[model samples]
Target: MIDYQSGYILRPVNQVFIYFSLFCALMLNLLPIDNYSWVPDWLIICIVFWNIHQHRHVSVILAFGLGLLMDVHNSELLGLHGFSYSLVAYLAISWHRRILPLGLLTQALHLLPLFLMVSLFPVLTHWILSGEMYWSALSAALQALIEALLWPLATVILLAPQRRPIHVDHNRPI
Candidate 1:
C-alpha cells in the first residue's frame, strides 16, 4: 500500500491516461440525460487534477480548448466555460506547488473557493450581462459542494495507475 503521508513518491503518470480521463469527463458531460442543476462539473475536476499533478502535459490553453467543447455541450454562451476553465487551469498551475504537499482532505477543502468561482462565474456574468441568472444560487452551491467532496475521490482514482508498488528489496534503493 502506498503511504498517504509526505515523502511517498508516485510513479510518473502516463500521458495517455491523462488524456483519456479528460476525454471521459467530456463524454460524461455529453450523456443523453438532461443536464441537472446539482451535477458536478467533471471536466473542471479532471482539469484541476491534471493541472495540479501534471502541469506540463495539461496547460491553460488545453483547458480553454476543453472549455470550448463544454460551452457547446451545455449550450451556454461561447467562451464562458473556456474562460472559467482557463482560469481554473491557471490557478491550479499556480497553486500546484503548494497543493501537492498537502493531505487529501486538506487539498479538497482548499479547492472549495476555486470550485465556487468556476461554478458561479458564468452565472454571475450572465446576470450582469442580461439581468438574469442561468444557475440558481442554491444549485451552484450544491454543485460546488459536490465537486469539493469529489476531489478526494477523484485524486485517489486518478492517481491509482501512478501509484508505486511497495516491495522489499534490499539491493534496490529508491
Candidate 2:
C-alpha cells in the first residue's frame, strides 16, 4: 500500500462522479414530494456544494447548462433557472475560499442570503411581469431553512469519497 507523509490519503475526484451527482440532484428536483411541492432546491444545493468545495470541477458554463435543463424540466421560463443557478455559481466561486474554513453551520448561515436570493429573483420577475405577487415570504424562508439543514448531510455524502484516501498497491509491477 502507498503511504502518505501526512498520514492521510486522498483520492482524486473523478469527473464521472461529479456529473453523476449532478444528474441525481436534477432527478431529485423533478421528484414529486407529495403535497409539499415547495421542497428544498436539490439541484441548487448540489451546485452550491460543488461550487464551494470543487470549484474547478463546476464552472459557470456548466451551471448555465444545468439551469437550462432545469427550466425545460420544470416548464418555466427558459432562462429563469439558468440565470439563478449561474448567479449562485458566481457567488459561490467568489466566496469559496472565505467560506471553506468555516464550520458547516457557519457556511450554511453564510449561504442563507444566496439561497434567499435564488428563491426571490424569479418570484420578483414573475410579479413584475404578471403584476401579481404570487410569492410567499414564509415559503421562501422555509425553503432556505430546509436547504441549510440539508447542507451538512449533502457535504458528508457528496464529499465522503473525496475524503477517503485511495489504496495503491506498491507491490504491483507497473
Candidate 3:
C-alpha cells in the first residue's frame, strides 16, 4: 500500500479516475429530470467530490472546463453555469483541507447550503438574462431541499475509492 503521506500528486490512475468521474457527472447533468425533478446538480456534486479529495490537482480550472462543456451541451448562456461553478469550486477548494478531515456525513451537511447557493445563483442569473423569471420560487425551494436531503448518500457514493484487486496464494502461506 502506498503511504498516506503520498501528498497531493495525481497519479496516472487518479487522473483517469477524475476524468471518468467528470464524464459520468456530465451525463448525469444531461439526464432529464421531470419538471419537479428531485435530482440535484450532478456536476456541482461531482465538483464537490473532486474538491474534497483532490484539491491540489483538480481546482477551479477543471470546474470551469466542465461548466463550459455543460453550457455548450445544454445551450445555456456561455458563462452562466461556468461562472457559478467556478465560484463554487473556489469556495470548496479554499476549505478543502479543513473540510475533508471532517466525517463524511458532516461534510455533506455543511456542503448542502453551499451547493444550493451555487445552484440558485445560476437560476437567478438565467432569469435576469432572459428578462423574466418564470419559474416558481416555491418549487425551486423544494428541489433545493430535496437536493440537500440527498447529498449525504451521494457524497458517500461519489467519494468511495475504487477497490483494487489483491493477489493471494493459498498454497504459499502454511
- The local distance difference test score of each candidate is 0.87, 0.81, 0.69
Question: Could you give candidate 1's per-residue lDDT for residues 107-156 as a string of tens digits?
Answer: 99999998998988887888899997654454787788899999999998
TM-score to native of every candidate shown: 0.91, 0.84, 0.74
Clashes of each: 0, 1, 0
Candidate 3, residues 1-174: lDDT per residue as tens digits? Answer: 121222222223367777788788888888776545366677787787677666776789878988898788768789877888888899888877767656656776778767777667766886777788867643555555666676667654654454322444576642
What C-alpha root-mean-square deviation, in Å, does candidate 3 show against the real structure? 5.2
User: Among these predicted structures, which one has the highest lDDT?
Assistant: 1
Query: Mind sharing the TM-score for model 2?
Result: 0.84
In model 2, where do residues sit more than 4 Å from their true spots? 1-9, 34-38, 135-138, 165-174
Model 3 regions lying over 4 Å from their true place: 1-13, 135-138, 162-174
Best by TM-score: 1
Please write out the lDDT profile of model 2 over residues 112-154, one tens digit for every residue: 9888877777778788788988645437767777898888788
| Span of 10 residues, lowest total lDDT, candidate 2 | 1-10
Checking candidate 3 for backbone clashes, the offending pairs are: none
For model 1, what is the alpha-carbon lDDT of residue 28? 86
**Cα deviation in Å at residue 92, candidate 1?**
0.3
How much does candidate 1 score in TM-score? 0.91
